[model samples]
Target chain A: MNTNTQTTRLYHTALSPYCRKVRLVLAEKKIEVELVEERYWEGPPDLKRRNPAGKLPVLRFRGNLLAESQAIVEYLDEAVPAPSLMPQQPLERHEVRRLCAWFDDKFQAEVTRPILNERVWKKITRSGYPDSRIVKDGLRAIKEHMDYLAGLLETRRWLAGNTLSLADFTAAAHFSCLDYISDVDWDRSEALRDWYATIKSRPAFRSVLADQVPGIHPAAHYAELDFG
Target chain B: MNTNTQTTRLYHTALSPYCRKVRLVLAEKKIEVELVEERYWEGPPDLKRRNPAGKLPVLRFRGNLLAESQAIVEYLDEAVPAPSLMPQQPLERHEVRRLCAWFDDKFQAEVTRPILNERVWKKITRSGYPDSRIVKDGLRAIKEHMDYLAGLLETRRWLAGNTLSLADFTAAAHFSCLDYISDVDWDRSEALRDWYATIKSRPAFRSVLADQVPGIHPAAHYAELDFG
Candidate 1:
């Protein structure tokens, strides 16, 4: 437990999209957070103490331990209202939440988890070698998602609406993780790539850009400002 | 779509916790909602028309379609402020959202899905007979969750805080699905049972209690107002 209660701290793992979402939100809010990498799978004794949910991306802010990525982000947006990630209208806000769930639940289950489990987690956890079949399936599944996202981007500037809302950050979080492993085919959708590049260049995205997981290397164009 | 554009309609499935959570919130807010049972697994083309996410619990309110259960519930609470399911304070609201995620994500993964997939979905989807191994594992998992929830009940009057909030509805949604198959050993934790009983007796819980899935019989005490 970092006794520096004065400073906002985040207990997280780099690969987790949930954690990344919160981190992006915190950074976008301009809150300087002390990042503490937790090997949560090791079942650290203090994990349950910090969060009963026993999950990653637990935020210690203003003397309270907050869990659940969406919950924490929503709280942060409400607590510190600057450069608002959420829109004003209720309907727009609903779209933002829905897209957030799209990445976290649907996209994660279909594309991210299977691909990450086979390619990333297997290597890191020393579980086994990547399953080509699963990776192939995830890659195939991602095309449909890319197409759907491309359709959305054709009409709107961001994932959910016009302005860069939480939806954009939520999507960028997932894509960034998949990008870390070079799973994303930027050539599939130029619109999707453009949207991602726009969000990726933000000052708030700097910390995430610097993430370097041991053993795994970033893609050649990952940190580059203009890969095109 | 139901031609009664004036009335709020929810396209949902009976056993989906996500749907039930929305139903409970709408009922709590005393909003008259027309429930449309959607067999989303069948993949009707119009499903995407109603909800691009193509999931259950798509709410049609104020002539606009809403997807994502949590988002819908939050919007309902915001649109109808009289019976607010969310707390005023950001911290308390965070706790509510966190617990909602606990049941929707963790508990559903640990208990509801495995057991239901074995005992319920197998029958509904005509997949196969109940897999005792999965059923046993899910049942075993429920004990720990019951204990944890019981511990929470000991300290607070409600799941997230002192008042009945979205967390309780989110939890009860999963619990009701488990209870339908007589899976929950209500005797495991007296406090959990008591907590459930109190919530179950509410007017808002009526529609859910009356849920009768075809070919799958409800437990004898499921609909009883004062079942011990």
Candidate 2:
């Protein structure tokens, strides 16, 4: 644990689940990095320069810039090589990566898309009139994802196997943000709910839970929930 | 090289770029596995059971199933640790993962969207008229992506770094599929063109080059090109 490097910097936002996944990875790895909040919606010149795609959670190390949350997390995992998020078995590792991609792709497209577009994106981008159709769809999609997640947790203590990996973090990050707005139906998914409680209670999760987004109030239920 | 136990099987499609990426990884890693061709477009019930999302390139090992090309490729690289696609350094590894995600997300959404939608998706889905606006935007976006890729390759022998990692395979897979339909402008991206030639000529790529979809004819230029 004595190998310390001060040059690691992470460009991220408090609300973005993707950013939070990278943050959780860094914390789990016990890596201290300078966290620079980037306003991706504003598309600032500096942010654009740092990431051509203007995405958040862009990690900079020694003059090299890396974009994409998946990439950043993998880099951190490989760099630290402790408390590994990846499994040792090839098939088990595939399961972890598959779930990670599922959250990034399927969940992002289905659940996060509609809700973020309605509640967060509209407020941030000043885009008027949250599409009711999309909001309805997002809400519906969350139920299906929850059912799928419940099934995964039925056999294992955590998603994508017993040990906590990036998959759990990625899923929790998205659900936590949605839960803040009372968008999550905890009663419908007891196993998944219990699993999240464990993750939310982790030392790495304290900062994320404490984060505040301006002008958007969290649901009352979010505060009362116990991690244990 | 004594650690060899093959419990691997790749679920893929001949024409899909994502499937091709996994195939390239398998070849690079010198891993042998059973290949099962899945028709995702008109998939059987079993395929959907294997992958609920009904996406192609699901890798199975010892009763466990893994979906998503990026995830499948990483699992392969880790499973067979020789001929590594990732760099030994943490920072460099991050660069590779970043580039791979870039192609999978931005490039797929922007460049592959139009061409695939217009040419492949249109024919495959047999849906209504192609959206002109989306197609136009995709064409414009491809130009920008090509330019960005050109700049990245200028400094290194490969996309992520000096070695041919999964990033190069991801890019080539997308470009190769697009090339089948003669969608890419080789003149606008001579550097990428040259790099692609090198990728196309690999022994692993032979299966992809030979792929053909029924009722759809490949462009004349595709057969003539030598990736070597």
Candidate 3:
């Protein structure tokens, strides 16, 4: 477990879904980390050095630096092997990773990108030209994904499987960001809604929902949601 | 690990980086399974049923289905528990995952995407109008990523650290694809070139290099490179 290793340092943004996932894992593992808010949009020189890809959720451990959310999460899971975020079965683990990738890939591209465009990324990346069509598509995709989640939740208690895992945290991280803009339809699937409510109430999840980005505001319902 | 589960099947495509990562891990672990090639682009109904997200490298284990290369690899590492792909130390494990994520995320976005756009994705996805600018940018990015890899290799024998790990396999899978298009500048970094040759020479890696995608021809250099 490398008990000799000191508390890890994470460079992240308050509003990033990827960062939120890492934060949730850390909190679940009960590992204390020094959180450094990195202004990634500013293209800070130090942040760039921390992450060559110029992405957030970079971790500094024992004079070595690691980047990428998947890597960070897996590392955290392995580093602090308590309450086991990953399933022991190879196939079960695969399902968890697949869901994680799905959230990162399709969900991000179809849902998160659109909402972020309407909300945060539009002002951050400065690419400009936020088309309403994309937002409309994003809104639709969210409902579809939520339906899929509902179906999964129908059989299993959690997103990937029975026990709470990183898969739930990954999904919740994305949903939380969208919820900030009121983009997610909480009522779409009562099962997923209930699952989220349970997740949000977690002590680990509290910090995520409490997170605030400057000049932006979360929807009124965010504070009131109860997935449990 | 699961001799009785030898009926396990790996649903994969020959050209996919994610799929290839799983293959390398399986070979390294010396786990044998029936391989079923799924043409994700062709829209296989069975594949779709197996993975609602419709991705490749879905593992069928004892009537149980799993997905995601990262998840599959972790499962293999844990289930087998010999010649560990991940270090026991939490920080070291995180380092391995962080590098894997780097290749999968940043490298895939910057380097592999460009090559896929120019060489394969267009043919597979039938997406029209490829951007020349993006292809050029991808080629440029590969050189930088290679240089960064060389810096790491200069100090360590493998991509992540001293021992062979999944991190090397992830990098190699992407490089193999790029090598097929003759996109890599092999001579630019002698150290990386040598390290890759060593990995390529592994008995486990032979099948991956021998893979052919019907009409598309691989670079002549692909045949002559000796990992041994």
| Candidate with the greatest lDDT versus the true structure | 1
Query: Taking candidate 1, what TM-score does its chain B reach relative to the real chain B?
Result: 0.97
Q: CA shift at A136, candidate 2, in angstroms?
A: 1.6
List candidate 2 stretches off by more than 4 Å.
Answer: A1-8, A61-64, A225-228, B1-9, B29-36
Clash counts per candidate, in order, are: 0, 1, 6
How well does candidate 3 reproduce the true complex, by DockQ? 0.63
Across B68-131, the per-residue lDDT of candidate 1 in tens digits comes to 8988888888878877789999999999999999998999999999998888888988988998
In candidate 3, list every pair of residues with a backbone clash: A79-B90, A194-A227, A197-A227, A198-A227, A198-A228, B197-B227
| lDDT by residue (tens digit), candidate 1, A168-200 | 888999999999888899998899988888899
Is candidate 1 or 2 superior in TM-score? 1
> Model 1 chain B — which ten-residue stretch has the worst lDDT?
B1-10
**What value does the lDDT take at residue A102 in candidate 2?**
90
Q: How accurate locally is residue A112 in candidate 1, as Cα lDDT from 0 to 100?
A: 93
Q: Which stretches of candidate 3 lie over 4 Å from their true place?
A: A1-8, A32-34, A61-64, A124-129, A225-228, B1-6, B124-131, B225-228
Q: How does chain A of every candidate compare to the true chain A by TM-score?
A: 0.98, 0.92, 0.91
When sorted by DockQ, best at the front, the candidate numbers are 1, 2, 3
What's model 3's lDDT at A108?
A: 90
